[model samples]
Target: MGDVVRAPWDAYFVTGFDTCSEVLRGRNWLAPDFAWQERQDDPERWGAVATQEMTKTLSRLNAPEHTCQRRSLGNLFDRSTIQRLTPVIEEHSARLLDDLAEKLRWGEADFVSTVSEQLPISTIGSWLGVPAADHPHILEITHNQVYAQELLPTKSELATSAEATGHLRAYFTEMVRQRRAKPGNDILTGWIHHWDAREPDRETADEILYRLTMFVTIASLETTATLLSAMVGLLLGEPGRWAWLRENPGHIDAAVDEVLRYDPPIQINTRVAAEDTVLAGVPIAKDSMVHVLYGAANHDPRRTENPDAFDIERRGTHLTFGGGVHYCLGAALARLEARTLLIQLLERFPTLRVTTPPVYASRLVFRRVTSMGVSI
Candidate 1:
């Protein structure tokens, strides 16, 4: 068990599994609080506008609105929907792996660009009904927007992020308009129909649709890419681990779960105290910022034996997907992508090895592997 530690910024860090769970599940804790907003260097700048657009996402919305939006978009990612996506995931993974194998013949290749980054973006793009040719453009826009979260983004970087945000909003707005006129078998169309059936007001529905599109696109692209990069780097870090996975292909699911718990992409989630409350014997004033360290909670010894060990067979659940109402909506889709890709990779290159040390991005909130050189 861990004690609540106070930071110089007056924020509380909850690390223990039970304490973090209490904070995450407590109704008194609300997201999109002042903590995240405080990270903005200048609220008057263009970056602030881009940040505002992102804060309108499902992850940042409060109850009632959050509840309704989540319910509306829930069906699209239900178990059956994710299961149906297996073929699509496998197809993309196989195609990417083939390209990777061909490139590896030249000695080495950056797996992050060749496979890790492209797979998730392409898979999510297809689900969103984006034209295959536009997937790269969408990827570039989202990637730029994510840099706004860097600890200290330069003025130029923030301006670039703002420009990208503008482009994304416009593109999705037009796409939503088209999808409404001609519904498709894609998730975006499903979302529009769901919003129309419930929202009744066209303008409000459009706003909701735009924000939902941004939320899903960026979340799916960045998090899944980070996960794939980290998983590959970790598995290949120990040569024996790759061989073990290749031999036990059926363990892919467990392996993915272990990776999520071991080194989650999103390391910390923040919430504000909605009301004065006491957590784990600590008194928290109303509106206090509470930082739930998901990575620390996942590694809590009280929650799992040998918490630091990456054992696929380890039992119990992890806080990586979060818990309670705010649990990750795309959890199933992320797992499906990781599992399918890992299985296919092992089958194609059981002897794959990391040719150089993996490079982790210098960000406190997201565990992103910026580069991982590999060869077979």
Candidate 2:
């Protein structure tokens, strides 16, 4: 595929690395938010509960609103915050790996369940001060809710995602109420305080607080979990890679980057033209939807040599975390978690081996490893 091509679905696809970068970083492009949704000819398509819930998220908001809402969480995943959370990541990784080790000793253990899915929620839950008991439910609902964000969701998936969204709203709404009644030192409490100071009405502040909590949890959980699973799968997918990583611990950072490039968690983002513009010499009309294929861009041979090969020692950039203002807020935290987990897992289980090929969810947008059995 070239830089830009029009698909039969009435959307422009940008696959080249440079063109994808331009589309992502360009101010003329906008996320298809609530305002954009309303402009569509099909209201029913945009009227799904999942779509409604997503419109309320920070990621779906345009500038001014996006800027103001984003400002609420100042330096959330900054270097200092990541440094502070590194120990938390390590603790969760070690605990999960310990359980995984025991399971592996007996027989094959599903890394996706035993560690990959568990570690992210544990780390983020600890940071948000959510009760440890609630993590499993939260994780389940999060997985359900993400179906709506997929490249194309079926009617059943949308219904399931709607149900999950409802559960998330109820859970977080209650958590917000309890936090207001009784304050704590956790990030959630801090957000309540921060919002209360800005918004005069308590109920409005509480609502914002509730969404923020839900967003933080939903945003941080699944993708990072996928990253963890993907990294481990890539390392163990081939012989000697894990052992090589164990020996060359200094390449952990490079290994993480290569995993992100080779198989990004989120592959595609749809951006609308804020104004009539030309991309890759093709005229795109205003309000037209453009699918920016980050996964394809990452592998564009023009930018990356031998794009199909997974070389940990290669140094390069990728659109995995996205670009511009909407760049992933949890990038640093995700990286820290991956690095910490890799370090601890390698040190703890040198004989760990993949027992079977990884099983992946049949989805386009989010690359999820549903199951991967491993044994010591």
Candidate 3:
């Protein structure tokens, strides 16, 4: 726990920023009402606006169901599996740099929409057997779909997102059909064959298609992009820090972690307590809302030395990537993507510097610097 933690809202069950060991308690730590998401409460109404295909599978899953789903999917992102994806990571990153070079040369570029957004889309598209030309469209659709829950309005946005969902489902359905006829080495191809072999009737090939693609694409895209923005954003503003990277490139990973700690890509996680429990000395009934504050906890001076300073040499755990059962499955992939992107940025623009203050996304949940003018 840090000195400046975002304590539980109840205020009576507990207080102060405490170590995760204290606040989280156990692997089964569920504050009151953690499972009660706002969207799920009005499924019928939101389904009219959200992707009908995803509501039951993703947004409505409770802890037990989520645990089971995560377990099966977790194996796909295991340390070994993720390590094997490095070549894919390297290839996508190199291509991203090449694309950026062509798109903007000796001119102003919006780093977020143009560059940061390309990474996970390319990687995920490649993994899913999606055609390269279709990645940008997929990213646009997925970006809206991911945020539809928190910030969305009017029927027009809903119609556009719904259309994307249909396109995606149709695309993956065709891809699965192709993989079934002629299986390949790709994950999409493998999963199709594997699921049919194991569960047969229960786990049909296309049953998990759309949601899985959403899980793969959007999860990797947003977090990785935000991390890249935060990491590069900080360095671009401080010439001395950029110079340090030019001198010692190996320190990039530490700086990436420091970025997550200093200004995390993700600021908070929404939780609903599974049952009645106490948090920070506050008592609560079942299903209370819980938020693990990443920003405040990362700045807690008790847990970190000079928590305010963005020092690459500093070492401590950060909750930018949630905790326990809800830990981001894509953490390793996001790290790899950010690291590779940083390397490419260094090689392409060693003297890169920010020409103006970065313009960030308005969303509070996801800390993304949407635009940063850079000069090479």
Candidate 4:
């Protein structure tokens, strides 16, 4: 439900909300110690997380603060900005498909690492002014970070994530320093100036580096990669729908929206209530965690007709990218990449077909398929 669709309707309406924390994030939303403030007096774990986000502009937000940051970002991320990126998206998609055609000319290829993963990597990297050469590195780090804290994660996976985080932090710090010394017209450079111009010393250069890199790392890599993989797999499963999209090129946007609704990359989002709240008659205590189930909400029969069906012409926006104060910041860019990639695929491989079941990512907060075998 976008805004309480029906009885037993969602309260927060997306993956980023806090109430259903355990259901979505394996976190205790009602834990007495739950705090978004990141107070210094909190336990060691909370403090550690707080410190980690000191430089993360995207993560360092709560309620009104989050709203304001989102607004500021939105000012630069509207339809106009997305429209500007269309040509670039198309160009990148063309190059990627060219590479894919060469590799799979014999009629078989793993489409995940080769296709789904590449779109977001190059798009996100180019937007942030990073060399295309670094796309693979960013993708690897992002995958490790997201998977490390996943349910039933192995000890080595946890350790690898920690190590990746440490190294990633160090890498971004240098990247930021270099960018600041020589400003550019890229997203990261523009944001660094946006913050510095407001308060010259409020946020240190190191903090700027940490936040932008982390956001770009995940926003451009993990979520987009998942959505791309899922869409490809879903299309391959129903060859009829795939063929329809190929014919009705204008329906690509609707197709992207439907894929998000059916198999959202980030399945759940968490948010904390600052005061006592009642959602669908469930009294939520102050500071209560609420997990907004986008997957559940999207499939709720009350809100949608034939909820599970993949309709390329589905109407209305769902809460897959989130809503209100914390809607996704990278949505515009993600949409552009998807359209470009799909367009190129349809134009080149006249007989695109799936040969194997896709391999899913070992994560619940975000679901991604790392492999999909396709035939031309």
Instruction: Output the number of the TM-score-best candidate.
Output: 2
RMSD (Å) per prediction: 2.7, 1.1, 4.1, 5.3
**C-alpha lDDT of residue 49 in model 2:** 95
Each prediction's whole-model lDDT (CA): 0.82, 0.89, 0.65, 0.66
User: In model 2, which runs have C-alpha deviations exceeding 4 angstroms?
Assistant: none
List the pairs of residues colliding in candidate 2.
none
Please report, as a residue range, the 10-residue window in candidate 2 with the lowest summed lDDT: 38-47
lDDT of 2 at 178: 89
Q: Between the candidate structures 2 and 3, which one is better when assessed by TM-score?
A: 2
Off by over 4 Å in 4: 1-34, 37-57, 63-74, 148-157, 202-205
**For model 3, how big is the CA root-mean-square deviation?**
4.1
TM-score of 3: 0.83
Instruction: Please give, for residues 214-287, the per-residue lDDT of candidate 4 as tens digits.
Output: 76567668888888888777777875777777788888888888888888888755555557766555566555
lDDT string for model 3 (13-86, tens) is 22123644344435335522223444256554355545445544533355675665565564667777777788
Residue 1, candidate 2: C-alpha displacement in angstroms: 2.5
Q: Distance (Å) between predicted and true CA of 174, model 2?
A: 0.9
Q: What are the per-residue Cα lDDT tens digits for candidate 1 across 208-310?
A: 9988987888889889999999889888876498898788777888889989999999988888887788888888987777788888999898888899888
lDDT of 3 at 330: 77
Model 2: per-residue Cα lDDT over 1-376, one tens digit each: 5798997777888999999999888999998898889888866567899878888888788898788888999879887888889887888888998899888778999999999999989998888878899998998999899888876688899999999999999999999998788998888888888898999999888878887889989989889989998898888877899899899999999999999999999988989999889999999999999998988999999999999999999987799988888989888898998999999989999988888778988888877889999888
Q: Scored by Cα lDDT, where does model 3 land? A: 0.65
> Between 3 and 4, whose TM-score is larger?
4
